[model samples]
Target: MHQPLDIKDKSSDKNSIKVEAFRKHVRTTKPHKHNNYFELIFLSQGHGTHAIDQEKIDIQPPMVFGIGKEQIHYWDMDAEPEGYVMIFRSDFIMNSHDKALLELANELFSHSHILLSKDESITQFFSLLAKELKELTVSPYVVEGLLKALFGKILQMALHIKPTQDKSKNLYQQLVDLLIENKEYDRKVENYAELLNTTPQNLNAICRKIENLTASEVIAAHIVKEAKRLLAHSNSSISEIAFHLNFKDSSHFVKYFKRHAQVTPGAFRSSSLIEKRN
Candidate 1:
């Protein structure tokens, strides 16, 4: 029997947040998904590729990668990597009840990769954060403050690297969050709009404004993305996948996948297998 992608736990049971030197833990990893945490990696030095879902990024110094909980990623480092890795869960933010901070994190986590310019402030921030995390008497308030500042610095640099629209009171982010949270493959724009407390037209307007796609398109895109993940990472057959995704039948799923991805599910799976082999 074919095995599924590995699911790894990189959490700190003692605290909601954990920070460590990346070099100490740096190694090539098989494709895996983390268990319910946000991972932020800052590399001062590294060489190789980091594949997050479908996108493979070149490892360049002074860069950061924010891996979300649902993303599948792997490292193929050709050299020793020097960096810091910070792991935190949503519980850390939710416990604070800081809506602004939660929104900031949501925006930052939306991007999987960010190339950074040389910034002494970022290095200093990470160093200070690591030091604080090591203290026997760790201060939650101080850690929270440091995290905010560090995230701000990284986001500031991210703006210059890739300009994103202001997501203040971001309905699009909310919609995406709901989509990711959902498990039953309910990809209806009307259902999501209702849950978001807005009309489908308004949701579409917001989605189009932020993502240049209709709400329906955004939902379809998410469905396709999940489909691709299941195809590549799971050992389920097309019929099983269709059932799991709540499609009426396997034939319907095949047509839908083809309409969006321009290839049949079987073809996609075959290509994924071939890619894995070589």
Candidate 2:
């Protein structure tokens, strides 16, 4: 069975940092990305294609990959793949701090919609942070003190990463920002290309080059993801989700879900709830 992408949709205040770390062995392969949290992966062991957007970058052990919310990236897991992941809300970091980090946070991982911070010093800091994080799972109240230190340490390390290449990413980022604002609208790729003052073929080519999927596919994925969220997190029925998504009817939405997700809306919700219980 395919698991939904690892998306942390939990809430946290600006003053508090909520974090969790775990090790998992890969039993299957899938494409997934976070929609609500920033992710830092300490790849302790494993090898896989870190497919960011549409571009597949080779990932090796002992490297940390940082992914931001709205960044569509995933790992096609291989055997014995284990890692430490620390995810916190972006509110945990401030804009002044963002100015401090500058390109480090932005370039950590990049494709079209996202860029990850990959500075050597920041990577090392997280290696140490991951060790400390493992301690919190056992010791408990250590969370508050350590969380502050971790954020500061990250800011410190951000100083070392160089500025990133902006020309390649700017256009795609605009498209994704537009996506965040207008998921309810059925905006075509041609529409985006025209808005960007480029040809449909050029926009499609760039999207595929950076994200491994077409612009249309990315929008459809968001629709499916939102549908799943409403299905699992709310009391809204299938018809409501379909209608809310502007589908003609429930049948249309059902077929749409099955084509990409390989599971009925009801079945997906039931399985997600079961996972929560376990």
Candidate 3:
């Protein structure tokens, strides 16, 4: 199982955030997921396909993509990409007292992507942020303020194209939340539908309408995600992991993993170890 890519601040400051030019650091084309921090990418120059949560989005320059924590994604770039990638933890924004900014951060993550027309001011914001990052003497408070301003700008752009609230979205989110919370013990779509006080058909329809996946697919995806995490990060044996996830047996677990991941559990673990070594 491929472990999610967890990028962390190596700086001495425990609550540190990171900002860097995109082209200088990103080299891989492999698909992966982030474990903790939210990622905000400003694409000033690039052409590629961004796969986020199983949706393929064509990368258009002068657009921004905000990825929430624990989301799976990858980039397939046709050319060298150039932009700024800002990664910060939720606590970075939570430190601020600005209620509106906090709400915008939540909204940005919920949406996952935004399209912005060519704007010099947005480009300038990233440039200034890069400069601040380079200055060793810049105070943490100043950096926090810059982050808030950047989020504020993103919020403004996001609001312009925000869609009206709908029942499908609400139902989908509720189902996803329940699946995530109970993935360890519950894998049945019917159980989730019952917990949400809806029929299996209704749940499936809402999931299909909102995420292009059936309710069973959504539940399995969450379970597979957790399984991958354990396979990559833990020292548990295959049988132990199977029992932990409430599988009937190790053979059944292996069959399920191969059906979904297209690789045996041991092979996945080996590949993940190789990637980590590199």
* lDDT of all predictions: 0.82, 0.59, 0.71
Error of 1 at 55 (Å): 0.8
Candidate 3 differs from the real structure by a C-alpha RMSD in angstroms, to one decimal, of: 6.9
For this target, which candidate reaches the highest TM-score against the unseen true structure?
Answer: 1
Question: What lDDT does candidate 3 reach at residue 198?
Answer: 93
In angstroms, how far off is 225's CA in candidate 2?
2.0
Comparing 2 and 3 on TM-score, the stronger one: 3
Please provide TM-scores, in order, for all candidate models, with all chains considered together: 0.90, 0.49, 0.59
- Model 3 pairs whose backbones collide: 1-268
lDDT score for residue 195 of model 3: 88
Q: Compared with the true structure, what per-residue lDDT tens digits does model 2 show for residues 13-44?
A: 53223444435754343445566566766555
lDDT of 3 by residue, 1-278 (tens): 32235444322345356777787446345555665566888887777788775467887777789876556667878767888888876667667676545555655666667877555777778888888877868777677667667766765665356633454665676675565456366878788888889999999998887678888888777777767767766678888788878999999999988888899889988987896586
Backbone clashes in model 1, listed as residue pairs: none
Per-residue alpha-carbon lDDT of candidate 1 for residues 1-278, written as tens digits (9 for 90 to 100): 33567888778677788888886456698888885787999998889999988788998878889987778899999888888888888678767755556666766777787777675788899899999988999988898888878877888886355434565336787787688778897978899989989999999888877778888888888888888888998898888888878999999999999999999999999999998888
* lDDT: the better of candidates 1 and 3: 1
Model 1: CA > 4 A from native: 12-14, 159-169
Task: Compare the candidates by lDDT and give the number of the best one.
Answer: 1
What value of lDDT does candidate 1 attain over all alpha carbons? 0.82
